[model samples]
Target: MSATASFLARRAAQKERVRILYRRALKDTLNWAVHRHLFYEDADRLRERFEANKHVEDLETVERMIADGEATYNKWRHPDPYIVPWAPGGTKFTRNPTPPSGIFIEKERKI
Candidate 1:
């Protein structure tokens, strides 16, 4: 691959990795925060952490920062992440094939 193409590919991959890391960190913060207000504060702090390094022009430095961010996120990851009550992963939403109780079906009328 040409040097420019290789650089662009590496940069794109790095951006994707950073995006994933940011999302994971945000969700992990939710696990720690009890209230929505607290979560907002924590999310802002996380954004600031990313914004602080948003202007580095060197690819090597950006890669190094990405590595550091990943390491920090891994070290601080929540042991048990919180799942939304209505989400697929949560207990309330998961169900078997059987229909829920209390629904009565009406007999179809012949025309």
Candidate 2:
């Protein structure tokens, strides 16, 4: 195989591994949350961290952290408000520029 093909294949495999780790971590987080409220308290922080670091190329390293017991779901909550999400792959958080108007807003406003 050409070097480019090899690189692409490796990248694909890496991404798949990352996805697996992500799913496992998500499952662990959910399980922990179900068992105790501490995990629930950290949900937002965990989501933010995962969203931030989700696209790192060295997925194995991150996976190791998740598997190593150091990345417990509760670790998401520490000091002050919370840790910021990393915005993985250099993606920015795009807020909705404008709110939806008219009927939907009016109907909800009644409650």
Q: What is the C-alpha RMSD of each candidate to the true structure, in Å?
A: 4.8, 13.5
Candidate 2, run of 10 with poorest lDDT: 77-86
| Candidate 2 Cα misplacement greater than 4 A, ranges | 35-43, 54-111
lDDT of 2 by residue, 18-91 (tens): 56655655655565454557666656665776687666666457557555534453465223332234443223
lDDT of 1 by residue, 1-111 (tens): 699998998888888988998988988999999999999999999999899988786889988998998899989988878778768878778555455688776799999
Q: Which candidate is the best by TM-score?
A: 1
Which whole-number lDDT from 0 to 100 does residue 72 have in model 2? 58
True-vs-predicted CA distance for residue 110, candidate 1, Å: 15
Once all C-alphas are superposed, what RMSD does model 2 give against the true structure?
A: 13.5
